[model samples]
Target: MNAWIGTLIALCALALSAATAYVQHRARKRETLGADVTAYFHRTSDFARIKLFDGTVRQAGYHLVIWNHGPAPAERVHLAVADVEGAAVELADCPPDEFPLQRLDKGARYPVPWIPVSDTHRGARRFTVHLRWQDGNGTQERLLPMRRGQTNV
Candidate 1:
């Protein structure tokens, strides 16, 4: 009788250990899924005709673009741009102060409006792009610095 009771207690302890390990595994999986939604923005340029006080001028303007590289989709996305040096910058064509991107799917790219740098901002070489979005887990925010020659996505 003593041996049977000891065996039963040992079995219960083993079962409890297995159950605890399974719960921990599931928690780790959930954390991994939440961390999978990584995204970033990059700098790109294109030429277009923009209107000025004098007339229309064809010029190359830079655009800040965000590309979703993760497997999950980003929702309720927003973006803002600012010069890294805190210098005054002018945009030939201004984008909205805040973007209301409803959804950005995986492998998708979203470009802000083209901003032609004026002579005053010529010395600025780096800019910060602030991005916020929601994934399957919750909301996330990132501030990325983009340089003239470097790109991140």
Candidate 2:
């Protein structure tokens, strides 16, 4: 009976060891080979002319920017917006060749020339920017909480 008990305990210890090793390996792999991209709403003072949906150019100082903060490069970057606490928003009037970016290297920043459009969006906006990209490991994604008219989204 004592021998059986000892065998059971040994088995549990071995299983735990294997599980820990597996977790560590996965973490290392992702850290070294995965792409971590982030998107945020940026507030600027340029007040650049941005064309509205109705072909009317307006001066706005807010925009979106994408950055890859990982060791690996990101490919096929895509963006999606979701309203977390306030009105939903959609990007409109983007340049023709600026979207669906093909590649972005690590530590690189890309200006996302997009304007937010919504019928009922006003006053203290809360949203989420979904960034999806492909790396050596697989397709990785991240969600960034954002607020309008702020640079630290």
Candidate 3:
């Protein structure tokens, strides 16, 4: 009887430990995805074309993929050009009709168009965009440095 009681006690302790570990794992996953966001610069896959009527002023086209990989959704997401350098790009290009997204659910992807005012597009493409959004905490902002291909946008 004593041995059986000891075995039962050990099993109960093991079960409790497993339950605690499972709960902790779930919490860790939730913490990891608190509110993360990223953007990727899509170069040519978009097949965006631009033809300029004026010889002096030219343009090139590209797109960006903004993604929210967080567990919670981001609201009122807005993107705007912050700065441009080493490139002859348009500074006041109007944003897409979807200026401020109503809501970007978790793990959602959004695409935005980019048309630079340069045809050759030589030299470095150092442009920065400011991103703003609202989440559980409050308003959040990020600066996205543009690059050529699938770089860290």
Please identify which of the two predictions, 1 or 2, would achieve the higher TM-score against the true structure. 2
The residue-by-residue lDDT of candidate 3 on 20-49, one tens digit each, is 999999888766545566677767543554
lDDT of 1 by residue, 1-153 (tens): 999999999999999999999999987766645423333434344454466545656443445567877667888887666686655455555545445578888778865434445664544567666678888768888877767553221
What does the lDDT read for residue 17 in candidate 3? 100
* Candidate 2 ranges with C-alpha deviation above 4 Å: 1-29, 51-55, 85-88, 95-98, 122-124, 150-153
Q: Which residues of candidate 1, in runs, are more than 4 Å off?
A: 1-58, 86-94, 113-119, 150-153
Candidate number with greatest lDDT: 2
Q: Model 2, 48-135: lDDT tens per residue?
A: 6776657888655676789898899999998777777534466665544555789999999987544665654433467788888899
Candidates ranked, most accurate by TM-score first: 2, 1, 3
- The residue-level lDDT of candidate 1 at 76 comes to 80
**Candidate 1 lDDT:** 0.63
- Candidate 3: worst 10 consecutive residues by lDDT? 86-95
